[model samples]
Target: MKRVVITSVGAVTPVGLDAESMWQNVKQGKHGFAPISSFDTSRLKVKNAAEIRNWDPVAMGLNKKEARRMDRYTQFAMAAAKQLIDSAGDLSGIDPYRAGVIVGSGIGGFQSTVTEHAKFLEKGPDRVSVFLIPMMICNMAAGQIAIEYKFRGDNFAPVTACATSAHAIGEAFRKIKDGYLDLCITGGSEGSINEFAVAGFQNMGALTESQDCDRLCIPFDKERSGFVMSEGAGLLLLEEYEHAKARGAQILGEIVGYGATDDAHHITGPDPEGDGAAHAMLHAIREAGIEPGEVGYINAHGTSTPLNEQCETAAIKRAFGEHAYKLAVSSTKSVTGHMLGAAGGVEAIITMKALEEGVLPPTVGYKVPDELCDLDYVTEGARKTEIKYALSNSLGFGGHNASLLLKKFEG
Candidate 1:
């Protein structure tokens, strides 16, 4: 199998608009959760969310016409893709057909769909825009990215709910490792912070109802009620290790293993025994050719919902045994406020940065830890430590479980 490594990264989240800024804010334990500003939330009980503010697509080099046809999620994906390609330097030597995109979103163009549906009700079917289908589909995030960069290989979106981007990235790694592709753009993006989305989550009892910014999404904490709804995008440039080395590209990190599984227990809830989640982590660790003790950190899928945190804790312990207690485990969602489909992609960036910079990002807003989730959570801000291997976990709706293992790039 060919070795695959991350060459560059791009991020657009509530914490920061770019990769460097996002890393800085993450290390500082800065919180991104606040009230939703994109739409009115006067009627909904869930008001606060981690929203990207003051973002200008045109300022980010997006053309006016293209922006109009795209939904906010695609816009975010394109913005992140441009950032990744630019940071990767000149890729002129690589064949565009060998390089492809695999970005995913749990809900695509949700806001656009909601608004257009309202027009259809008010002014009949003729009032609906012809671009509605292209704008609202879940796969357009990947499609638009491919169209923009002229990438013609293995382009598609993996819609596994919250595991959406994690699966996209994991599959991309497999393609490169198995000699199927030379390079790929992979990650997850989301833009569902609208009234209808919020109302649906609120009605389903899935969103955190807290109005306070600091207490919104307290992952693994005793007071954690549910996940905070948020929106953003994360994109990564992945290349064959030999190709990256030959081009003199700076390697960010190496994705050594990927594991995906399904709970088959519930649609929105994980298996109470955490069997599938544990297996996902164990599979990733085994594929990385490393012992459980060799893993030093984990970016947990701690959604702050009671079920997710408790089950993830059990799954970690089940997978790593004593090493789980020793590892510097933390949830970036505690500060980033659960970017839904984009969670895995953004968390991957945070985990890679932790391995690269030798620091552990904290699970902020955690004061009283739940006994069920007792682990070495890095709650006291950033901790400087050498991390040879780090794992990022993402458990999504419909029992989807995905884990990715990354090793520090030494060569």
Candidate 2:
């Protein structure tokens, strides 16, 4: 089997526009939550979201015509992809057929769907734009990225709700490890912060009602309410170890193991026993050929929701035994809000950064902890620590669970 290594990473996040900038912001324990400005929220109970402020597609290098035809999520993906490609110097050596793209979005073109549907109701079906269908599908982000970069090998988008991007990255690792491809671009994007999307989530009781930015999205805190909707993109470039080493590529980290499982328990709630999530973690650790104690940090799927935090804590204890207490665990969602499908990709980047830099990001806003979540939550601030292995977990709405184990690149 071939080894898979991350060559470059890029992000379009609420806290920052690029991966390095986001890492710096996270290290300082900064958050991006604010009142919803994308639309009037007077009619809704949820009033705030982590929006990517001052976003200008043209400034990100997309022409007006291209931006108009594509959905906002796709635009975010393209921008992140551009950043990844730019940082990955001299990729022209790899064959196009040996390259691939896998980008996923939980809710793709939601604003487009709402806008065109409103137009159809107001005027007529003919009033709708011609690009509606192509723009609204969840797979267009991957399709557009493939077209942009001309990658021809095994390209597809995974749609596992919040676990979407983790699955994307994990599958990409498999493609390279199994010798199906030499290089791949993988991640997730989301742009569904409009009023309609907010309304749907709020009505479902999945959005935080806290009007205060400081109080909102407090993962693992007893005062936690629900997740705040956020929009952004996170992408990474992965290449075979030999392929990257031959080109003198700057390796960021190595993806050593991945595990995916389904709860089969509920539509929107995790299994109360956390059996599925525990197995996923164990599978990942087992695949990495390392003991649970070797994993020093975990970027939890701590969505700030009561059920998610409690269940994930239980899962961790079940998987790691006594070592669960020895490891540092945090949820960057407390900083970035819930990016939904993009959460996995973004958190993966953060984990890789933490492993490379010897820092563990804190779960900001964590106060009044619950007894159920008794592990070290890293609430005070970012901790300086050297860790060999880091695991990132992403659990989606539909009982989807994915864990990616990354090792600090020693070579």
Candidate 3:
């Protein structure tokens, strides 16, 4: 099989606006979740969120008019794409036909969609802005990035709920490996923390009932309850290994394996036995031709939701046996909150950072770890260690599960 590598990464997360800022906050065990300020939350049951606070996309070099027409989610993606391209240098040197984009969103511009719909209802059919459809469509995230960067290759925007970004990245990996594209920009974005989204999560009991500052978003903790609504975007520049080497591109990590599965049991709940989740992890391990023991750490899909934490624990144990107890597991979500579809991509960056920096982030707010999740979670604090390989799992609503394996770049 052809080799694929991640050349550059960028992020717009609750912790910060770029990958370096997010990683620094992650290392310090910072919590981005706070009472919602983007919108009035006086009456909402879940009032706290990990918002991309006071973000001005103009810092990413986009003009006001252009950025204004874009919905917040798309704006975030565009900003992140700018960071990615800036870090990767001028892609103009490469063939435009050989470059492509694959980005996704679980819920595309919920705030924009709901706002425009309200306008139409409050005034007349013509009250909705002309940019409504363009700004609200999920594909626009990928489309806008491709247009800005002059990438004329394949562009896709998968919508698999939370699994959206994971599938997008995984599929892009296959494309590069199969020789369909030489360079691909891929990742996920989300900006759905509006009234409707918060209400929906609250009605479904997905957000924590408690407003306690320290108790919120405690993933894999004995008192863990539900996820905190969050917003952000993560983008990765991936290239064929030979193409990267020929160009002297910096390699962050190699994509060794990817696996996706469905619970086939419920739309919102994971299989209690972790059947589907385990299959995803095991499939990744088997595809990489590596033993479970080879994995040194896991960027867990530990969403801080009760069922997901428990089921993921079962899945890890089933997939790795004794190795499960030895591996360092940490949830970046514990600090960044849950970026939904973008979780996979952001966590992928975290895994690569861990490998490169030799520093493992601790799962903050893990005062009392759940008995079911008995593992060396690196919870005491950030620890310096050599991580040969790492796994990042992303499970979304609708029974979607995805796992990706990233190895420390040796070339």
Candidate 4:
């Protein structure tokens, strides 16, 4: 199998408009969350989110005319994709057919769907815009990305709930490893912060109803209530190892192994014992040919929700045993809030960056640790250490569990 390397990465997250800006803010533990501004959440229990602020579409290089048509999710994806494409400059030398784009989203164009549905009811079906279906479908992100970059090899979307991006990226790794394509842009995006989503999560008791927006997303804390809804997008340029070396592309990191599994247990909740998640960890480690002890840091799937944090902790203990206690595991969600489908993409970047910089990001808001979740969550701020191997985990609805193992580039 040919080796796959991540040459470049870009992000348009609530924390920042681009990767550099986002990383700087997140590293400083600066919270981007505040009272929701897109809608009047005056009557709602949770009125805050990690909403992207001060982001004018034109600021991201999008014209007002073009920005008017795209929904928030597409805008974020486009911004991230543009940055990644810029990083992989002068792709004209490579055949467009050898390039691909695979973006994922659990919910796509949600705002578009709701708006068009209202229009259909108020006006007529004919009043719906021609771009309604094409724009609102979950696969449209991938289609739009391919069209923007003229990538012709592979274009598709992965929708596995929050595991959506992990699966997309993992599949991209396989495509490159099998020599299917020389370069591929893969990641995920989501923009589902709406009244409907809030009502649903609130009814199901899966949302943080705290009035303090700044401290609502307290992942892994003993008093952690629920996940703070957020929106964002992340894109990564993946290329074959020799192809990247030949072009002297900056290798961001090497994706060594990927593993995915389904629990067949529940639709909304993870298995209490974390059987599915543990299996994913085992599979990824085996594929990487490494012992449990080799993994120095883990970007955990800690969503600040009670079930996920507890269950994921159980899974980690089951998979790594004593090594789990020795490793540094932190949930970037604690700092960035929950991005739903885009969660995996941001966490993947976090893991790769930790490997690159040898600094583990702290999981903020960890006031009182739970007994069942006994692990060193790197809470004493960023720690500088040798991170030879890093693992990123994501568990989503439908019992989806995805794990990706990354290592420092050697030889």
**Candidate that scores best on lDDT:** 2
lDDT string, candidate 4, 180-293, tens digits: 999999989998898878878888998899878656887778888898888989888889999998888888889988989998899999999888998898898898888989
Q: What clash pairs does model 3 have?
A: none
Q: Which ten residues in a row have the lowest lDDT in candidate 1?
A: 33-42
Best by TM-score: 2
Give candidate 1's whole-model lDDT: 0.91
Q: Is candidate 2 or candidate 4 better by lDDT?
A: 2
Any idea what lDDT model 2 has? 0.93
Candidate 4 positional error at 288, Å: 1.4
**TM-score of each model, in listed order:** 0.99, 0.99, 0.98, 0.97
Question: In the order shown, what is each candidate's alpha-carbon RMSD?
Answer: 0.9, 0.7, 1.0, 1.3
Report model 1's TM-score to 2 decimal places.
0.99
Clashing pairs in 1: none
Tell me the whole-model lDDT of each prediction, alpha carbons only: 0.91, 0.93, 0.88, 0.86
Candidate 4 backbone collisions, by pair: none
Candidate 1, residues 148-193, lDDT tens digits: the string is: 8888889998999999999999999999999988999999999998
* Per-residue lDDT over 84-143 for candidate 2, one digit per residue giving the tens place of the 0 to 100 score: 999998887889999999889998889799999999999998999999999999999999
